[model samples]
Target: MSVREATPVTASTEPPPPALRASARSRRRRGGQWWVPWLFLAPALVLFLYFKFIPMGQAIVMSVQDVKPYLGSTWVGTANYGEILSSESFRSATWNTILLAIGQTGGSMALGFGLALLVEGQTRKLSFIRSAAFLPVVVPMAVVAELWRIMYHPTSEGLLNQIIGLVGLGPSGFINHPDTSLGSIMLTGIWRGAPYDMMIFLAGLAGIDRGLYEAATVDGASTRKRILHVTLPGLRPVFAILFVLAAVRGFRSFTEVFLLTNGGPNGSTEVVMTLIYKLGLEQNRLGVGSAGAVLLFLATLVLTICVQLLRRRRSA
Candidate 1:
């Protein structure tokens, strides 16, 4: 091989013209101005401050005070939080919230992912099936709640009870009974949310490299092995995203629980949000409600961080 002498890097010893130097200095100054980035971010920052941070501050402040609607407020210094913490209802609500998050997240992810696998990348004849599966997702939550309420009727005439009768079973108290109320509402939530998760999982599955499956098959892997070794590994990101999003959404769940049980049948379905609504709106204990809200916010924040950390660890 022919060898060539390497060129040495040289520094410019001569100074530029004063005007060019000034121009360069100005450019550097402009580049370093911190406010330039903030200028672009100002709108979003203002909205977030107004809508999210400011409200959060207000809630934190309110949590320590006694807030009576129209009657004015008084500083109580953690009394509201103390009262809630000491209350049986508050404890029950917190426990219920945890159970709900677990049940809802697990049920939706399981059912949705299962359904996605079943119909994954099917032919035209199966294309229409996803649309029908997604029908429950489009229905308004209030309507779904009411519909499920009717279906959950304790009497034999109720849809669910009637279906059970067909299987040679007797009528059972679903949402009408305290012991089963939470589970019944959970089923309703799973039914409503599963289709949405299914769509997301289907999208993830579709994006997976098909050749991985082919390769797995050629390696004499069974169907289950293909899913475990090829499919699931490729979907780690999607799983992480869905897990966090679903858990966060589960934290704020109130509608179906409200419409179905309204934290009733002996307060068995009283999740934190419902309790907050009761405190802030119906019972007019805004301070206590705000405290509960703050606790929920913190819980969600912690849960989110934990999930993200878990995802990072798995990825690493």
Candidate 2:
């Protein structure tokens, strides 16, 4: 009698209807099967296998054989490698490549990082400066190289030499003398490349939390101290990317050097890729060129792997 009939026991255990069913945005639909993404990637994978990997494989095979465009390849089993190792041209090319890589990479990174730091602050008004810095990157490198060739004409009327003359320095041998040719090319490479590197650095800098800076300042850190501790540490990942990319770019540099001097001034600018071009395309020593190319690929691969390992270690 005291139970009051229990309201006919009609209560249900189901969840309540959501108050606003349409309020929660739906997740983008994903493929039902795990293989769906692989399917989507098939085209790119096939293209890479065909274009990049196939060519790379062919190059490797050609490196071990005496090869040419019209001539049949004769397998020589490391003879090509042996010849390259013993050749004076290869030695000179290797040395020049090392110097060029070091110079370009160092110069580009230094200038780019400095510019990035200059522009990445909260001051939104300096966008013009950023644009100016990056303009060279967007311009065709061939055009820049051509412009620099005019500026580096190794005479009094050359634009760079004229500017130097204004500063009381006599005419300089910019691209003519062996002593200055590679250095001159390096200047152009660095100047044109720094802006591109700066863009990457800017992106990395933007990802850094302002709160970290505020906290560091609260702890009485100086500007340089904050940069050393917070900014640079935060940019290690970016630095890895930049380093690998710059190294690769340095290794692959062709157009500027090709147009500027064609590895001239007594082969002072004969970097590996340039030497490869001369051997394969100009001299028709396809096997030797392929060997050089293989070396370039190996060098690039090693650099990339080392960078990845370094990043992992730093992050860990």
Candidate 3:
């Protein structure tokens, strides 16, 4: 038997393959260029810092002090908050805000979901219809407010009143009367907001598993049943997202209400934002207004956090 000679094997010291070398170089380059993105973002960041964050910080500071434009602000501690919290008008505004939020959020979501279902197709007719329906969303809020204001004129000659007259309904003082002011504003909000929600819902619907619908249909499920069991479940995340957006939007509603009713008819449509605006700009109660604004910000934050927590729990 011949004896076999064993050779010692040495570890290869060659550089990594071209692909790996290129990846490593790319990562190193990316790491080195981390500041590049910040450089590009500098202009926007500076604008935000000056216009947004600085004002936000100033607001927070002003919330705790009495702000006088010429005389200068004085430290009032928490008195501003106390005053705002105790004001009867503020309390009423808060209540109205909550009611308006609920009405707008619920109405917009329901209407948007229905519209999404109706227009969920790739056909040209459906596309055209969707675009037409979305016009309200794209129209400036001021324009929408003015448009609705005209339609909501208390006179019988008003566009909306004319339609209601055909249905045997008498001309109602829509925004002029306190009884229907808030509701009239809510309808305006819903009409404008539903299209945005519909677009979001259409995107969500596109992401849904079509096979599930097929299977449900194969199982002889009716349209309502399929919507209840499959569609709703599939769009659960979208619903949560929309609910947060709608709630936040409703809570901060100001422009339309300001333009249309201006919290008129005994302050029936007075929302928190309008109240804050009145306190700060109109009445020059900047301290109290800042306090109110802070409270609103906190409320919105809490609402968002609660919604996020609930969504996480539901997802789990």
Candidate 4:
């Protein structure tokens, strides 16, 4: 036979191996499963778009328009923003807002974390204490403000003043005095918000693996050392989230300030939110109010971004 004819032809074309075929089938299955997550996420995404993103877009548009009372808005690009930034009231309000944010956020987080640490291992009576700590969170802000206002009244009839009088201290107008008004408002905010932070910290503490504590104990680690090395590391994410949330809430505080002091005592308690409310509702200057809102939005955005970046860095 001729050599060419005698040569057997080998099969070059073959079906994919079983593993490759199974992998391809698995990928297709995964593609089908992708819709499940999307389906679950659709409702939340729609709500976010409708409520958050759309309102933000509208606010940005409104910031540039001059909306007169009883007359429709007219486009006056950037004029409202200029006026808002240049106004003395805006400057003072911004300062007060910053002070409130710093005081409330720092004070609440510190007190809450301390309380969480104290109650971390307790089981019986601590549960009742925890509930008591969290009760303020359920109370409405307006009600808390009004309650504090009565307690902070400038007269001898005030609860705080009566207590001070028992100690031979002169009655101090806690909420009416310019020097004390901002601080008093900050204290109220801290009292109202600390419970939430405490709860968050408690949840984070509960999630920590007990094995780490046991291992540290075996290594003769002190309680403070264990906390510094283990507990704090475990709580980093919770702390970051809580701090950002508290900062945002404190910065936007309005109802409490409005109900308690109405930015009184020479505007010592004035905050950005109160200014925005006055500009929009009282003065009928929607454009200026929108500008203040936009500024607050930007500040919050910046803070959120910074927190996210810090979290990523810590995780890495």
Report RMSD (Å) for each prediction in the order shown: 6.8, 4.6, 2.1, 3.7
Q: Write the per-residue lDDT of candidate 2 for residues 190-293, one digit (tens) a residue.
A: 99889999999999999999999999999999999999999999998888899888888888888888999999989989888889998888898888889989
The candidate, 1 or 3, that scores higher on lDDT is 3
Candidate 4 lDDT tens digits, 118-147: 877667799989998899999988789888
Writing each residue's lDDT as its tens digit, candidate 3 over 68-168 gives 99998899999999999999999999999999999999999999999999999999999999999999988999999999989998899999999999999
- Residue 56 lDDT in candidate 4: 83
In candidate 4, which residue pairs clash?
Answer: none
Give the higher-lDDT candidate: 1 or 2: 1
Judged by lDDT relative to the true structure, which candidate is superior, 3 or 4?
A: 3
Minimum summed lDDT over a 10-residue window in model 4 is located at 1-10
Q: Which regions of candidate 1 fall more than 4 Å away from where they truly are?
A: 1-52
Note the clash tally of each candidate.
0, 0, 0, 0
Tens digits of per-residue lDDT, candidate 1, 85-193, equal: 9999999998998899889999999999999998877788668998899999899999999999889889989999999899999998999898899999889888988
Off by over 4 Å in 4: 1-51, 218-221
Model 4 error, position 283 (Å): 0.6
lDDT of 3 at 313: 94
